[model samples]
Structure formats: C-alpha cells, structure tokens
Target: MAFTFDGPLLLVGAGKMGGALLEGLIAQGLDAGRVRVQDPAPPADIAALLARHGIAAEASVADLTGPPGVIVVAVKPQVMDAVFPPVARLAGARTLVVSIAAGRTLKSFEAHLPAGAAVVRAMPNTPAAIGQGMTVCVPNAHATPAQRQLCEALMSAVGEVAWVEDEASMDAVTAVSGSGPAYVFLLTEALEKAALAAGLDAALARRLARSTVSGAGALLAESALDAAVLRHNVTSPGGTTAAALAVLMADGRFERLLKEAVLAGEGRSRELAK
Candidate 1:
C-alpha cells in the first residue's frame, strides 16, 4: 500500500538501516521536505541524499520541531534510554512510534512516552541496508489500526513487513529473520572454504559460492514453489545433489544444528532485553 504522511515524519537515526529506509521512502515519493532526520554523524551518502532532496537533518533532536505523525527510532538498543526522552516529547497520543532497535520492547517505549502512546516494536536485519530486509513488528495495546498500518507502511519502505499478534513471538522472530542473514553468509563462507579445499582456485571458489547463493535466492524469490520443492526439483535420486544432501541431512544434523543456533540467538535477545 502507498504511504504518504501529511504531518512531519521524524527519523531518529540515519545509520545504515535508517539511511536505507530514508532512501526507500524518498523513492516511494514521500515528500522530503516533511522529513527530519537526527544523526550526529550520517554517512556521506545519507548526507548527500538529504541535501539533494531538501530534507532537514541535524545532530540533535532539539533541532527538530514536531508533533510528528510518525517517529521512527532506529538507534542502537544500548542507547535507547538516552534517545527516548527527546523522542517522547515529539509524540502526541495519535503519534505512531515505530522502533527498529533490537531487544527493546514496546512496553519499554510506552514507559518513556506519553500515556497511551502508540508504539510498534520491530526487528529488521542488516539486509535492510540494501533494501532486502524482512521486518516483523508487534504493536502495543495502545496502537490503533491506523497506527499499525502506518508502522507497516514505514517499514515496507525498506523491505517486506509482517505483523504479529503475539508479542512473545518476537524473540523467535529475532532469532529467525533478524539474525538469519548471518547464517546465510556463514553458509557461503563454508561453501567457499570447502571448494578451496577441493582444489578449486580461491578466487574462483569465492565467486562461484557468491553467485550460487545469490542466484538461488533470486530463483526462490521468483518461484511460487516451496523451498523444499525447489530442492527436490534440483535433486535427482542418487545424483550428485542428492549425495550432497545425504551428508548435510544425515541423522537430521542440519536441522538440529539450525534449531540450536536459533535458540542461542533467541536466548541472547531475551538477555539483552533485560
């Protein structure tokens, strides 16, 4: 759905993910003049983009004038306490506050903001820097339907967005999509290393691994088939792919390892939330 906010939009950070969302919003025709960004040291690209588009950006939140319709907090989780007070001042009862800060809960935000302020707690991954992000958001009880939609629209600027009715699921969501990219990258690294050990040239192996992963991702995006189906289609019984799968899937090793990894991530997220 198209998203355009008539009132001011305040972005509390202009780092990688924040910059990506800013780029996406402008590309989707959100008026630059109505957007204000707060970042102490924005990357060169973000600074240039804001300047080119006539958007206002400052190092301090005090520079912004707001009762902003939307306030997106993209700061690091560790510094959220410092960030929220200034942000809270900009939030009216109708304001929708969407946060991409990992491990920060909706209730944590509500505690700092005005009574009954609408808030959405979101987890978006590093892939968001390139606009391939997957964001899962959960709204607090105070958030209205329209506020939730606005949060979804704002996040959709960078990549795909999904809403969760149960906030408890957010820990698992963080483990999955929020940390999923690193797992994919680790797989690529392992594949490249194995190829090199098999006598392939280092550069060639790296290139092949990169291409294979990216190409498979593209195919997955364009195909309607489930991933298991796609894997089956590529594997002929007793063939090379099947042989490789046999080792990877032996005694459910692969699935078990992934489950463990996700649990570790989820545990870490919960720990940080405290």
Candidate 2:
C-alpha cells in the first residue's frame, strides 16, 4: 500500500487502541526505528510487545527529539489535557497530529497547540485490535491534502477508514461504531443466559452463544447483502428462529430499543466533548 509518511512517529499512549495501531503499522512494514512510544505505564503484554520488537518506550517525551512526521494521541480523554501539552511542543511545520481519543474535537487540540497545527480527530471501534475496525476521521482546516492522505494510510493499516467534513457527525460515530461493541457483547451475554434458561448445559450454552454471535458477524462481514436480507433468509415461517424474531421484532421493539441505546451513547459522547 505504498506506505508514505515523512519522518518518524511518536505515539503518546500504549494502551489497547495505541498498542493495536502499533502492531498493525509494524505488520504493514512501518519500520520499528521510525516509531517511538511514550507511555509511563503500559500494560505488561504491551510492554513485552515493545521489547520484543526492540522498540523502547520512554516514560515521558521530555528527552525525545522530534519534528516527527506524525504524532498519534491514543490516550484517554480524561488525561488529554495533562498529557497533550508536552506533545504539542514537539510539533513542527511538518508534523500532523492524529488523535483517537474519544469525545475530543479537533478544536480541542487546536486550542492547545500553536497556530496552524494540522490536527485530525479519529474514532475507531474495539475491532481495531484485529484490523477489522471502522474508523471515521475529521481533519481541521489546517490539515493539508497530503496530511489527510497520510492519515488514511496510517489508519487503514488497522481497519477501513472513512472521512467526514462535518465534525458534528463524530458524536454519532462515537455512538454507533465506537461504543457499539459493548451492545453486541451484551447481546451475546444475554443469549448465553437465555440458553441456560432453555435447559442447555452451562458449557454448551457458553460455546453456542459465543460461536453464534461471532459466526453471524463473520457472515455479515463476508456477505455483500444487507443484514435484513440475511436475517430474513435465516427465518422461515413457523421456524424457531422466526418465532424468536417475532417476539423481538414485535411492534419494532428491538429496533426502537437499539435506537434509544445509541442515542444515549451519543448524548454521553457530546457531554464528554464539552
């Protein structure tokens, strides 16, 4: 994929999302020498991963030299204020900052950095850990076309990437894809309990529920058809699946419930941005 980004990258965090991006970038041929991690306390596994790759993590960016091609802030929104100031000092005319911290707007970074700091705010779901994530990005006015393209190349290494001109849409992106994994997980959790209630053994129930949810996701990913079409194909008249769908779909109950759930998440995302 003609990976192109001038200079090196300085990653500001080494947690789940950060760690996942690091792994993906390396697998896609980004040189280890071109990447540096700054995390005071990364998870044990991630620390080991850095060590194995011979990429040493700095406890702070205090001594790090830069004019890095990119600075990716994959930190928690709660600490961004404290953690980001130091990072902004490293920015040069060529640096592009891409942030995956939820609820942080491009304006938020602009407020802290010097004028003309090219900033992009991106939202990626948990699936990114395995490179199946859906990421949506919004770049500030300062970001150049080349920087935008570079952002796409950097992020697509971890998953599919999309762009939006309206940063307003990011709150919805946070609601739907960003926090949506938990909703799917809750369904699997509920299904496991329901299977047990229906007299299945514990082990079988666990296995069935987990496999069914994952398998259905795999099918959905592979098929070009819409999910509704796939659902209808599985549900025959008078069949068990049809019967269950009837109950869940009655009066559009399930769809309405899911809409409410997503709306709630959207509201919270907005709150965090404030």
Candidate 3:
C-alpha cells in the first residue's frame, strides 16, 4: 500500500540515512510541504535539497508547533536520549513513531513517549542511501494494522522491507543485513588487493573488483535461483573456479570465519541495546 501522512511528518534528523529517506519520500510523490525536519546543522547538500523541495527545516523540535502524524527517528543511538524527550511531546494518539536507529528497542521508545504510543523499531543498512536498502521492522503492541502497513510502505520507498515477529531476532537481523554491506565492501577491498598481487595495475584492479562485485550483486537480485545454485553454475569441475573453491571451502574455513564475524556483530548489537 502507498504511504502518505495524514498530518505533518516530522523528521528528527537530516543526516545521511534521514536525507536519503527524504529523497525517497519526495520521489514517491509525498508533498514536501507536509514534511518538517529538525537538525542542528544539516549538511549543505541536504539543506539545498530541503530548500529546493520547500520542506520546513528547523534547528530543534522545540520550534515545531503542532503534532505530526508520523515521527521518524533517525538520529544516532548515542544521542537518542537527548532527542526523545522533546519529540515525545509531539506524539499524540495517532502519531506513529518509526525509528531506524540500530540496537534501540521498541520498548525503549515507548518508555519515552505517551502511554500506548505506536512504535516501530527498524534496522536499515547503509545501502539505504542509494535506494537499495533491506529494512526489517517490528512493531509494538500499540501499533495498529494500518500503522504497520504504513511503516512497510514508507520503508519500501528505499528498498525491500520485511516484518519480524520476534524482536529478539533483531540482533541476528542486525548482524546480517544491518552490517552486511560492510562485509561486501571488505570483500571488494580484498579482491582488489588480490588482483594487485596478481600483477594487475592498481587502477585496473579497483575497477575490475568493483564492477565484478556490483555486477554479481545485480545478477543475484534479478535471478530467482539460489546463491548456491548460482555459484555452482559458475563452477566447472576441475576448473579454475573449482580450484579456488577448494581453498575457500576446505575445512569450511570461510563459513566458520563468517559465522564468527556475525556472532561478534550480534554480540556488539546486544551490548549497545543494553
């Protein structure tokens, strides 16, 4: 379902992810005039976009006059304590609060808002900046069906959206999709280094590594086959691909290393939530 706010939409931050969401909302045909943004010092580019779109921008939530229909919290987790109290004043019975801050729980938001306020906790990766994000949202009991649908639709403006029944699983979600982009980027860096080691020019190595990773990602997105199936398709028995796989797959080294990395990330997320 398409999402449009019934009243003014207040954006608590206009940093990278928040700015990206604003761009997506405008691209999806939401009226910029109905949006209000509060950021102490927005980046020059973001300020320009807000001016061009005629979105109301303020230095603080205290400058906002009326209650907003939707309150999107995009500030860093560290600053949420300072940001929540002032914004909570804007939460009426119908206000739907959607937070994209990692490691912050719905209960934490509810504690700061009015009793029974609808809250949705979401985790979106850095890819969201380019409209290719994968977001997972979980709503509290106070969130109605319509509110949940609205959250999904709003999130889909950036990319894929999934709903989770168990909030505890969010740490795993954080480990995977939330931190997943960095893993891909690291892989790209490693591939470039490997290419350089193989005598390729630095510029050529970077270009090839980037293109290969991006092209492979696009192929995975467009294809219905499983990733394992795609990998098998690329491998011919006793060939160069198989030779490389022998090392990567030997003693399940790669798999074990990845699992360890994910566990470490999950642990960190849990610590931050506390």
Candidate 4:
C-alpha cells in the first residue's frame, strides 16, 4: 500500500529508483491523483498505474505545475544541473525540495532555488526497489521543523530513514548504506562461488547462497539478539561453524578487509562530489 503524504507530490526522473518509490507510495495508499511526474520514458507499469489514478505524466518539468507540496529530485547526479534550474524557478516559497542524488548536497539545491528555500538531501540504496532500503536524510539550515517533518514523511514512504546532525556524515552514510546493497550482493556472489568450489552444482549453489543469507537476515530482524549474539548462537564450540569462524577471525583478516573497503567507498563518494 502507498503511504500518504500531507499534500501533492511532484516526482522528477521516473527511472528505476524513482519508479520503485512511486510504486511504494501507491502501495502505501497515497492519493495517486495528487502526484505528478516528469520523465522522458517512464516505465510502462508506472505510466499505466499513474494514469489509472488520474495522475499526470509529462515529458518535461515545464509541463508540470509550480510549487508542489513536495518536490522530489530523483534525477542522476550527473544531470542534476540540467534538471533543477527550471524546477527552482517554479518552486514556491513554501515548497520543500527533497533530493536523493548521491554526491549532491543541500547547498547545491539552495543555490538553484530561491533564498531561504528548504532543502533536504537524502542517500537511499538500491534496496529501495525491494522496500528494504536504508535511507539517511539531512536538512539545510533554512529548513524548518515542519519542512523536516514533511521530508521525513515523504521519504518514509519508500523505506526506513535516519538523520545525522553533521552534514559530513552524509558521505559516510553514502559509503555504508547508500552503496550497501552492492556489498551484500557481492557477499552472496562470493558464497555461491565458494559453494561451487566445494563441489556443489552452480544452480544449487546459487539457491542455497541466496536463501541462506536472506533467511538469516529475516531471523535477525525478528530476534532481540545482537549480531554478535546471533553469531555465537550459530557457532558451537569445536564445531563446523567454529571452524569457519576460526578462518574468518584469523589475523583479523575479514574485519580489516571490510574496513578498507568501506573506507575506499567513502573516499570515492567524496571524489564524486568534487
């Protein structure tokens, strides 16, 4: 079901991520007629669904109305400059600007909008497509509590959300959560490869790898136990699980490797900003 926001929504860039959010909103029971979207080639499913609800779809922002209650910027960061200037012109004084463009900041949006414009920057991962996304948002100084509430309500329609007082932490959030799905996918791939190396058929290995990881994650979600406790629960002394743990714990190898990988992601996020 689509979640309802306080008022109308204007979604820019109806690509994969944007389309997923639109579906989530409808699934949450948000009024589809109150939504407007602009995209060059919106997905067939999205276009049909929006049309069914009386929502308008246009090829360019110029065809959309001005000063939406919530204006979501889902366009790619590389094309943000080309996409937002006209939006800025159309933004009303009270319009809340929410951006999900990785590497772009609130200041960038503020620069394009009217003085004292409310801007919220968010980092959402690919998992949003599956409704398991972890998103982090932060508001510019000009944003009021009411505007923050609106942004939070709008983003929550897609997935869980958190806030960081320090804007610098946004880059770290991008490193950890924004790019986290790829890391998890990589782990699943490695597990499948390892299973194949252990003489399992490729198809069986993939099914086992994906199901095991996904099931364990679901269990963790339903449990009160912390991750460490969960790990200990699976590892009996002198058992196979313990044997695997021994290799993973040896010389702090896996921990160090993951730390390095996250640092690399963080660095790359900053580099993209430049």
TM-score of 1: 0.95
lDDT of 4 at 34: 77
TM-score (C-alpha) between model 4 and the true structure? 0.94
**What order do candidates take by lDDT, descending?**
2, 3, 1, 4
Model 1 lDDT tens row, 147-204: 7887888888788999898888899999999999999999999999999999999999
Q: How many clashes does each candidate structure show, in the order listed?
A: 0, 0, 0, 9
TM-score winner between 2 and 4, please give it. Answer: 2
Give the TM-scores of the predictions, in the order they appear. 0.95, 0.97, 0.97, 0.94
Better of 2 and 3 by lDDT: 2
Show model 2 residue runs off by greater than 4 Å.
none
Worst 10 residues of 2 by lDDT: 59-68
**Which prediction has more favorable TM-score, 3 or 4?**
3
RMSD of 3: 1.2
lDDT of each: 0.86, 0.91, 0.90, 0.83
- For residue 125, what is the lDDT in candidate 1? 86
The residue-by-residue lDDT of candidate 2 on 1-274, one tens digit each, is 6557777799999999999999998998888888889998999988998998999888776665557889999999899999998888888887899999998889889887889999999999999999999999999999999999999998998899999999999999999999989999999999999999999999999999999999999999999999999998998989999899989999999999999999998888888894
Error at 65, model 2, angstroms: 3.9
Model 1: lDDT to the true structure: 0.86
Better of 1 and 2 by lDDT: 2
Instruction: Give the Å shift of residue 264 in candidate 3.
Output: 0.7
Query: Where is the poorest 10-residue window by lDDT in model 1?
Result: 57-66
